[model samples]
Target: MTGPRWIAAAWGQSSLRIWAMAGRKVLTEGASDQGVSRLGPRDFEPALLTLANDMLPLDEVTRVLICGQAGARKGWVEVPHAMVPCAPHAAPPVPAPSRDPRISVGILPGLGQTDPPDVMRGEETRIAGFLLDRASFDGVLCMPGLHGKWVRLRHGIVQGFRTMMTGEIYGLIARQSVLRPMMDDSWDEAAFRHAVDESTRHPETIVSSIFGIRASALLNTPAPGLARARLSGLMVGCDIGAMRTWWHNRPVAVLGTERVSTLYASALAAQGADVQALAGDRLTLAGLIAAHERTGHLEPSAAAHG
Candidate 1:
């Protein structure tokens, strides 16, 4: 156990998470709020060290594997998108060198679609991890977050994908609009499904129903979670409707947290689609570790030297 450990980290818009791995087994982990959005010039290195320095040895050279917005144009370095119709790890990751020679960092590239114009960063790494062991998996991947992604994976290769702003739209209506007051903090399954079915069947009625939320709240005060569920379902239903080709009666593997993935599973199942959800943390780490192993960022022999 006395050896140099490899670093696996993920930086998002709001948070940074890292795991110290000693040959695939995590030795320690840490998290910080120093995500890309909160960082500026000369801040990336410090931010990473803030979470990693203590876990690393002073004499050994550490290898770091990172993904997410840290590789964005405004992040640590702008990594070119790995054009789709390529293996998950087809293109070598972008090299990210640093003034500090104590460690070396490699940022995995995101994927992009040309004709329809779409791009994704961190999620691509997560998908690569999911497919690391499932080389034969050929189906749709539903990644739900602030901006959900619908991706196509064929024979372990990332074919293409699209993004949806359903979460953003939900935030706007649930937190900023007049419809906000009617939304409940808790979930109502019945109400949620009702909205999904109705909205998917008749997206045009969403506007009128949106107004009804406020009216119901102000006058009738019909139910506690009625508005909240309906709003969520309506938004998701619309998203699914727009991307019917991706999920219509097709099996999908959802990657996200319990709430989001479960909701997607429920929505797709209602449409007679087979759905499976793989939560975020586990898979993201898997992807990062896979990248390090495949790229030889952390070789077994190197650990003995450390």
Candidate 2:
């Protein structure tokens, strides 16, 4: 491989992030709104080139290792999912058809489950990155996002996992449901904690509890901040309640430094679980670089030199 021979990309639904790399060190970085959701099959290469063309050399092909939705069924190239009870990077990178000879694109495969018919894209790469340094990690990984994932790992292999739609549900309730008028981004910590405690204790009443938010606004006109926090709490609490088997008394490392991650960490801490929050983006990049190295393209000596 030539110098600056690799590009690491994390392509999601709404945005695309890429890093030009000389081995493990990032040489330059770029991003755009041209996510997989907004482009057709033929548009992927061009969208990537628009951001990465300058990083390419004239004679050699620069390998682009991508994770996330770019490997979805409708993405740049539909990569298959690696079944669970396997290493996060169990499936090797699949080559995507590319036009420019200067660049070669390969996407990492996502993880899937059979019994429950569950599937995850992009997140598996993050899991791989998290386990890169923690080889003996024998616990659950709590990743909070629009589609939160609770992953169980033992002996460095993913045993099984579950997905929760807490964030998505919260978004719908806050923006599209009757509770919209009473919601805002401002958060009230006490209200959030109270809601979490209530919902975790009686998750079956969530439907009615949600309605109570609207009713409370109608009668008492609670601050929008409080209402929003309460709504988030209800959704996250329900998830925590259902995932007790995975998290109870376990060492859980929550991914992301975002507000959602904080909420999960707080809720898990309250439940008396050992918890720690990790930086999401850093791990994501590490996973991409790890995949790149595992593919046998970037040599260890080359990385050391860079």
Candidate 3:
């Protein structure tokens, strides 16, 4: 209360941060070196304290609400209690306040099992919040990333989802595998479309076709750029093929970067399905804020740090 008071909020793979007020103005800032792996409570406290030391005098700050991956960590002394269970059919409308008021922290649980016990450190909750109020659809929501997710949401609840190692696999093959020599770092729309065409037509060939990048250069079948595009296509195409049954007659919404979304849109269009693309960052942020609001931990006046 004497010097400055602050609140901190963080999401995703980004670094740890702090938010404070200077004079009549609010200041939000963070440090890159102070980042943590995930919000496991055990791993977060040290990081949080380190971040606090770097950005602000720890004693000056009053209240802190730790959420997201860092907040999910297992062991931290700052937050000492858990919310009690409500009645089976009479769950509380909002999250209850922590009995101790020194520091307020809530660790949201990840959706476990259902699909190989997949744990989304932060994205899952954010995506769930983003889908609130959307009409019910019996289709697939594909989130393309290093570890891609194909989620099926029915009646506003995640019915089931599948994770594919598409992006990571592509990066490995493109950067370290034998295919690296034959790939061009340049972009060619024609090559991309051709790859998409091949992938859509023969999805199952992706596994073997992945190595075809090297073969194509040696055999003089495709240019370096074309080979790169074909590799991408094969990976995406294989995923699409595996997911085809899920999207057969249903509308599809793709949430991710423009390139991947565009490719997915092209592939989906070929299958005669309705496709819509949403901004991945926007959705992720919205979902996160929504989760915070729903849990009553976030308020309209709450300012995000970093």
- Count of clashes, each model: 0, 0, 7
Please list the residue runs of candidate 1 whose C-alpha ends up more than 4 Å from where it truly belongs after superposition: 1-4, 297-306
Please give me the total number of clashing residue pairs in predicted model 2.
Answer: 0
lDDT of 1 by residue, 1-306 (tens): 743478899899999999999767889999999988898857999989988988878777778889899888898999988888787667666767577767777888888789789888899889888987788888899898888899888888888888998898889889999887676677788989988888877777778877877886679746878888889899888777777787766678989999888888888789778888888779899988788777753443345454
| Residue 128 displacement (Å), model 3 | 2.4
Candidate with best lDDT = 2
Ten residues in sequence with the least summed lDDT for candidate 1? 297-306
Model 2: residues with Cα > 4 Å off, grouped in runs: 1-4, 298-306
Name the TM-score of candidate 3: 0.71
Error of 1 at 303 (Å): 8.7
lDDT of 2: 0.87
The sequence of per-residue lDDT tens digits that candidate 3 reaches over residues 67-92 is 34453344232222221121101111
TM per candidate: 0.93, 0.94, 0.71
Point to the candidate with the largest TM-score.
2
Task: Kindly list the per-residue Cα lDDT of model 2 for residues 87-155, writing each as its tens digit.
Answer: 999988888998887877789999999978888888898998999999899999999888889999987
lDDT of 3: 0.57
